[model samples]
Target: MRWWLTAAVFWTLLIMAVCWLPMPMFPIGTGGEHPKRFPHLDKAVHAGIFVVFGLLWLRVIPGPRRFLVVVAAGAALAAITECGQNLPIIGRDGELADGLFDVLGVFLAYPLATFLFRRVRDKQPVVSMTRA
Candidate 1:
């Protein structure tokens, strides 16, 4: 559906803001230390969004090869966001671990999305622009 692509773009833009914006712009405080129970909450958050990101792209693209496209796109996004954060003026620290989590999230998302698609969809599907 058109909504999926819209959601994907919106999510990407949201990630851009969240990753690239200045630190103080955060209303909920930076990613240092907050929830004492989980020290790695930040990494979880990174992975979580990427799972959503991967799933959304899987929805947007059609045909058998979408898995490859979604994975490549997700990894590219992870790297881009990491590099964006690395920009000195952005006031954010870039971590390889965070990017790894992001890619891992994408990997984690693909099979789940594929399974759900098989369960819910039939022969004909409404997919993204490319039929291939």
Candidate 2:
């Protein structure tokens, strides 16, 4: 499969998963009232998107260029998702933390993807490109 296509699939699936199975509310030991909830499950959604997209990027684009494109796409998607959530029809609120989480996710996932790809490719042939 094409790398970008894989990324597209991953993004779609991740969103669907989050939408379909949202995190259940749990008390954060904040006493009888005004309980704070853990958001790890929510944050995981962003991390998952980044990790999957980064893997797709590593598979598709080679070298430093891969980082640039993948990060750009991830950032753009995060921004768009944040904005989209604000629409009345969406019945969602926008939060800066979500975007921040996405950025962190991309930062972590990209390096991990690169490392895994390299490890997987070790002792194997590297892709050769011909300049026109």
Candidate 3:
């Protein structure tokens, strides 16, 4: 199996675990005195996770339409994760801003993936010549 595929799968599972597992989530907690920290730190965390998710998908499936499709799927997953938190069984609260941030992170990966692949694709191997 390709390394990229492995990474993508691993990341997807990690995302599911992180989003679904019942844990004491900080910053997003409701009716609790959260730790004293910078505001909206959780928003940054949410965006950062999906950014890597988008990048991994781009590498796993190398094509325009396919990449877009995978990314759309990622966005859908992001939304679903947020919505899932709203379930009383999940013991977490969902926020519209968090979902927006997650989707924003997914798109953010586009330009980054483009830049990375271009740089790698355009890079030329250096050769040194030693002649007698």
lDDT of 3 by residue, 1-82 (tens): 3988999999988987778766465344553334476567778888899889988888888556866776688878887888
Candidate with best lDDT: 1
Clashes of 1: 0
**If ranked by TM-score, best first, what sequence of candidates would result?**
1, 3, 2
List the candidate 2 regions with Cα displacement exceeding 4 Å. Answer: 1-4, 7-40, 123-132
lDDT of 2 by residue, 1-132 (tens): 475676667765665444333223223321123225643566666667666765675567666677777788777767777777666655455567777777677778777876886787796977779877
Candidate 2 weakest ten by summed lDDT: 22-31
> TM-score for all predictions?
0.84, 0.66, 0.80
lDDT tens digits by residue: candidate 1, 64-110: 89989888988898899898887878878888999999999988888
Better of 1 and 2 by TM-score: 1
Q: What C-alpha lDDT, on a 0 to 100 scale, does residue 11 get in candidate 3?
A: 95
Q: Which stretches of candidate 1 lie over 4 Å from their true place?
A: 122-132
Clash totals for all candidate models = 0, 0, 0
